[model samples]
Target: RAYRMTETRGIIHRRVQSIIFVLIATACFLAVSVLLVFAPLLGRLAEAHLEWIKPYMGTITIWRYIIASTVIVIGLFSVHIWLPAGKRRFVSIIPGIVFTLVAWLVGS
Candidate 1:
């Protein structure tokens, strides 16, 4: 009974660690994406002297979409791979991730 309890505790500990890792990874990915993809667009809009609301109305470029899509795909991939309680194969998760991206694109 004691051995079983210790093993259960170990599993729970590892699960908690994986969850924290996934959260931090996702946050970092989003931060970098925003900095690299949106920062310049915002800077350009600021220089245009547009009104506060109009700045947000600035045209979004294809690069932004590409970067955002990449970030989302990566984030989803990490979550699908890491957050589950049991181990998953990388190949198995690809289809779900791709389907999710396609669904999001179509919905948007």
Candidate 2:
């Protein structure tokens, strides 16, 4: 009976771990999804900040947007790796690229 109880506990632990991992991955996916959907707005915000500092900066810091987009893309890729295969994995890249493009266009 004790052995059986131990085995059951171990199994439950594994299942709980899996559920937690999946939940975290889903949250990441949702976050990136929202970020992609609002990328244009984010771009506008970045642009506005740039405009505010243009005088002191003396030129547009295009590199800032490039770097930011790069970081966002890296995060998207990280989450993509955690997502299960099929449609979820395939669709993950689209928004990341769009976000990058929007950042570049709006920043410039």
RMSD of each: 7.8, 11.8
lDDT of 2 at 24: 64
lDDT score for residue 96 of model 1: 86
Per-prediction TM-score: 0.52, 0.34
**Structure candidate 2, residue pairs in collision:** none
Alpha-carbon RMSD, candidate 2: 11.8
- Give the per-residue lDDT digits (tens) of candidate 2, residues 21-107: 667667655665554556556656776877764353323335444555565566556544433233344465667657765886799
Residue 105, candidate 1: Cα error in Å is 1.4
Regions of model 2 farther than 4 Å from truth:
1-9, 45-50, 53-108
**lDDT of model number 1:** 0.68
Cα deviation at 57, candidate 1, in Å, is 14
